[model samples]
Target: MSQIVVLDTNVLLHDPQAIFAYPKDEIVIPAIVLEEIDSKKRLADELGRNARSVSRLLDKIKEEGKLHSGIKLPNGSIIRVELNHRNFTQVQDLFGEITNDHRIIAVAMNYHVEQQALPEQERKQVVLVSKDVLMRIKADVLGLPAKDYISDPHLQADDRYNGYFTLHVHPSIIDEFYTYRYLMVHNLGLRHQLNPHEFVILKDELGTTKSALLKVNANATKLEPLFLSNDPVWGITARNAQQRMALELLMNDEIPLVTLTGKAGTGKTLLALAAGLLKVEDEHKYKKLLIARPVVPMGKDIGYLPGEKEEKLRPWMQPIYDNLEYLFDTKKSGDIDKILMGLGSIHVEALTYIRGRSIPGQFIIIDEAQNLTSHEIKTIVSRVGEGSKIVLVGDPEQIDHPYLDSMSNGLTYVVERFKQEGISGHIALEKGERSKLAQLAADLL
Candidate 1:
């Protein structure tokens, strides 16, 4: 049976291509949704961009056929703009208001009644698809089937890749790896498949303290010893195995993309900065170190602050400056600024200004990346030019974006999508190293 999927305004704003997601089903865009999209198209943000894209898509679709009547989509499904849903008595009685959400729900309810009035064999299934939780609830209360429009598959917090695994093997294998510095993949007796650049802690089957740190090659065909650094980068050193694994990937120029995820105080930002500094300043692998992050407000926006662009960005980029001060060992209040001026190799900017420019020969670090959408991440990654590497560091659990969550954030999306690529690596830090109080708050609070 053909299905009628009514899309909500949030779905379209979240992803303009949502209309094409349901290829096998008929798409219904209520007239109210278009109005909502129109209201948001003038804003200056990612939502506005999506709204404009959706408008363009609708305009192009209009040329194919009249949107009021049924129009055949590329996938052989029908699409129609619903403009005749005037009856809202049922929704008004249930919700006590003819709000925009209720109006959209009323359209779905109208479709449901129409389908129900038809013969059972010829009736179509009507489902209201929305990204809003309360909207879906309201639809369900009105005897309409509603669901979340999930485009990407979600990974549970515990099921996410932690970059390193503990493998139980014989003591002899550990000895062989220590001596040869390389181990065969078959000899690990592994049950689970490992991705490229995945770290493994090989332990003896007897549960002794004997263990070896190894990393999977790009092809996942061989295991090699991790590149353990004796010297510290700036003043920071890897305090744990996971940190060590993250450092190896961060410093390796062969890996073009690296994602680091962890709770607050996991040393994600510190490690990334340390590695980026080492590669950019010490080794001169890249021309400069470019750091950018999404400017997601904590409680409210900083627009009302008393300054220009740099002043407005100071509050959002303070954390990055804090790490820089610590790494540069700024003894006085303004010592860090002097050091940065002398180096002239590091640039810190907002993610908003990074579009449409190709970045080449630079080490880019995108902190607080969980606040970005998947589309924003795609845009940032595509800007990488030759001889450049980008590091995305964020705590998925600590997202500040209202429309994003741990599983739906860009950090997790890139982690899951790039795990199989040889040029990419990821590590989820487990332990927190910020401070005792902060770590306790992250764990117990």
Candidate 2:
């Protein structure tokens, strides 16, 4: 049976194209939800962009038919605007409030009641879809079916690809890998399929220390030796196997996109910056090194603090500057700035200014990428032009975006979507290589 899906304002703001997500089902828009979207359409952020998109979508749909009655969607769904459900007495009796959320709930409740009055075979399931946790709880309290809008149905944080795996094999296979530098994947008799560029640690079947690090080739048919580097990059060397795997991906010009995910002290940013510098300055593979990060506030907007754009961004971008200073080995206060000014090959800016610009022949690193929505990440990636490499580094467990979590954030989304592509690579750093105190805090605290 077809079901009625009532969308909340937050769902539209989260994804403007959500109206078409459900095929062959009825989509109902509460009158109050449109009002809330209209109020947010003027803001200067991702929310405003999404709101305007929703407005355009609704306007286009309006041309099809009258929304008050019902409009046939391209996916065989029926969309209608519930303007007559403005009576909020039911919600007022339940929560004693006339807020927009209550009004939306009242619309769903009214529809549900009307549907229940029909014969059992003629009744359709009335469900409320929202991104707000509290709203879903309230719908449950009022005996209404509600669900969170999930953009990626198959994603789970615990099941994310860790970029590498360990397989215990016969000791002779490890010796053959060292001697020949390649092994046929079919000979391993593996149970799980290996993704392209995925790392593998071959240990002896006896559980001894005899091992070799290998990466699956792009064809997934052969295991090749890792490109291990002994030289220091900007005075930093790989501290662990995960870091080495990340460096291999970052320095490879063939791989246009790389994702590095880990905890706070796992050196994701440092490794990305170091490889970007090596490619830009030493190899001269690109014109410049550009580092940009989302300017997400921890608690409140940085605009509330008094200053100009640069001044306000200093606090949020300080972590980026700190990594640069360490790479440059700046002793004095202004040494890092002087080095950056003299080289004139490195640019640091907020992610807000990167849209609609074609970035070419540059190495770009986006830090704190977990705070970005999937759409925001798409906008950023779409800006990459010819001969440019983009690295997205973040700790998914430390997202600041209100609507994004570990499984749904842009960084994880990109990792999952691009893992199969030959030009993309991902590594989830497991060890914290910072100072012992910082590592301890990350683990225990």
Candidate 3:
């Protein structure tokens, strides 16, 4: 039987290419969904950009045939603009509000009823695709099949990659790794080869309490010891194996891109900030240290807040400011602010203003990256000019974006996409070193 996939407005806004995503099945866009897209196309944000993109895609399809009637796409799928299924009587009792969500669900219900009216042999599967959780629940309550649009396939928890693993090696191999300072990759003895720049914790197979931490080279050729410096970055030392590996990647100029993932109090932001300060102030490796994070938890527009750009962003960027204050060890009120005002090397920017600019000779740090989409991260990373490094740090499990999660967020997406690349390095911090209470909360809570 053929299938009809009804898409919600948020799905298209999240990924404009969701139309062509169902290449093997028929696609439907409720008339109310078009209204939602039209409402968002005028805004000056990523959502607006996606709304315009989806409009262009639908316009292109219009040239092939009438969209009101089913148009055949080259991918053997029929795309249709659903105009007649606007009735909400079927779900008025279940969902009292006749909002856009209700209208969208009503369209799905109409299609499902139509499909059920057909003979059993000729019935088609009708499913509603949405990013909204409540909408999916409502669809289920209304006896309709609803699914989330999985844009990146390898985002499930079971399929997610941690970029590091424990390998049981003979005690002799551990001694050889320390004596020769390198070991063969073949010693891993895995069913599949590990990714380049992957980290490993080599433990004794005999459980003799012998262990060593090593990193795989870019070519996946051999295991080399981490080239970490003895001195700390900005008087902050690594507390664990993962933090040490993270510092190794952060302080290295050879790798231009690095991703660090950890729960709260894992020192992701503190370490990235320390490395940026050292590179910008002590070592003079870059011209400036640029720090940015998406203001997603708050409303999108900064105009709603009072004062100039810096003052307006102060409330939202307090976390970054707090980290800076700690690094500078400033006790007096506004001491860090005075320092930031005098210093031209360190800059903190809202994620909004970083667009459409070439950043060069700077150590850029993007915090709370898990709240951003894959496209948003791409736009930020592509802005890196020559002689620049970009570090994305976030706890994917604690996302603020409505449509994003631990797996599908840009932080996880970047880690998965660039794990094998030579220019990139990643570390997933498992243990939280914030404090006794913080670590306990992270684990037990």
TM-scores, each model vs. reference: 0.92, 0.92, 0.96
| Candidate 2 segments whose C-alpha is farther than 4 A from its true place | 87-90, 116-119, 299-305
Rank by lDDT, descending?
2, 3, 1
The per-model lDDT (C-alpha) reads: 0.89, 0.90, 0.89
Off by over 4 Å in 1: 113-124, 154-159, 186-192, 299-302
lDDT of 3 at 54: 96
Evaluation by TM-score, superior candidate among 1 and 3: 3
Winning candidate number (TM-score): 3
Sorting all predicted structures by TM-score, with the top scorer first, yields 3, 2, 1
* Cα TM-score of candidate 3: 0.96
Question: How many residue pairs clash in each candidate at the backbone level?
Answer: 0, 0, 0
Candidate 3 lDDT by residue in tens digits, 188-303? 57787788888889999998899999888888889999888657889899988888989989998989999998889999999999999999999999999999999885465677
Worst 10 residues of 1 by lDDT: 149-158
Instruction: Give the lowest summed-lDDT range of ten residues in model 2.
Output: 226-235
Rate residue 172 of model 1 by lDDT: 91
Per-residue lDDT tens digits of candidate 1, residues 150-192? Answer: 6664556678877778888889999998898899887666788
